[model samples]
Target: MKRTQARFDVVGQLGALRRYARSLTRDSSDAEDLVQDALLRACENRSSFEAGREVRPWLLSILHNVFVDKTRRSKSESLRIKGLAEMSPKQLDAPQDHSVRLAQIRAAFMKLPEEQRTALHLVTIEGLSYQEAADTLAIPVGTLMSRISRGREALRSFEQGRDQTSLKLVGGRDVS
Candidate 1:
């Protein structure tokens, strides 16, 4: 691909890449950093990319790998204290009712296992097809389907206040 076209292709996928990064990182600043790192790596390895293939999935895969690497490296870092030290006290204010539901959903989403969360985010939130999402995660399409199913089930259980672990096997056979 021509240099100009290559640059344009990478730039065109920036929004999707940023959204996926935000879903993965769950923090704006960290998402930005992840996007930047992925872009840099993509540009550096541009020649390795096939000319006619879609770029979004490639960029997302790079972002996922970058996040995994960062997580592994940060595992050895010392814990940092978190507090409201940087915030200035303000007068008490009422919370927005609409935001409360969204917050609860977001909290529930954050509680899901990383694999399931990634599958759900890629397919439901990012609007990727099953094959595309599977390719991005380097998993089989069937595996992706299973993860998405489990993730949705877990979210539904949370909404309905059901205990997923309460079911017991019957006659040495599994029962869900």
Candidate 2:
């Protein structure tokens, strides 16, 4: 029906939407998510899409709104995270507890399964979004998220046990 035609028209402008989103977001993965969010919005509300109207500008407006919404939500959080990233170089110049802690963390991370390790590294250390990391690993985003969650749990376990190799003197016997 007419709704179906509107939906098709909206889909037809995906290329233009992606370009506008990329310019607005300045990150391919973020742009992808923005376009996706816009498409979802357009599909959900396509009933309001007027007939005989150009779809490209509407889709671009949806994408811009989506990007603006995300920016607003992440503004405070990004400021804090960005501050920490900016401080990294100065922090590295100082010799502190990082030597032992870094080694222990690395050893623990190394013990993770390869899939989990790769997912964690890509999403966390490499600063890739879940979608980008999933694409890099050729796995579904759900699978990538599962691996990262499991990897984090394993790392938490190691930290809690502190390597689980220390012997404690108790009742005239060694307790591990």
Candidate of highest lDDT = 1
Candidate 1 has what TM-score? 0.41
Q: Which stretches in model 1 have alpha-carbon errors above 4 Å?
A: 1-8, 78-176
Error of 2 at 66 (Å): 0.4
In order, the Cα lDDT scores of the candidates are: 0.82, 0.80
**Model 2 segments beyond 4 Å from truth?**
1-8, 78-176
TM-score of each: 0.41, 0.42
The CA-based lDDT of model 1 is what?
A: 0.82
Q: What tens-digit string does per-residue lDDT give for candidate 1 at 59-87?
A: 88988999998997776442321235335
> Which one wins on TM-score?
2
> Tens digits of per-residue lDDT for model 2 on 10-121?
5568788888888988999988989889899888988777777777777777778888888888997899999989877753444557787888889888877688889999
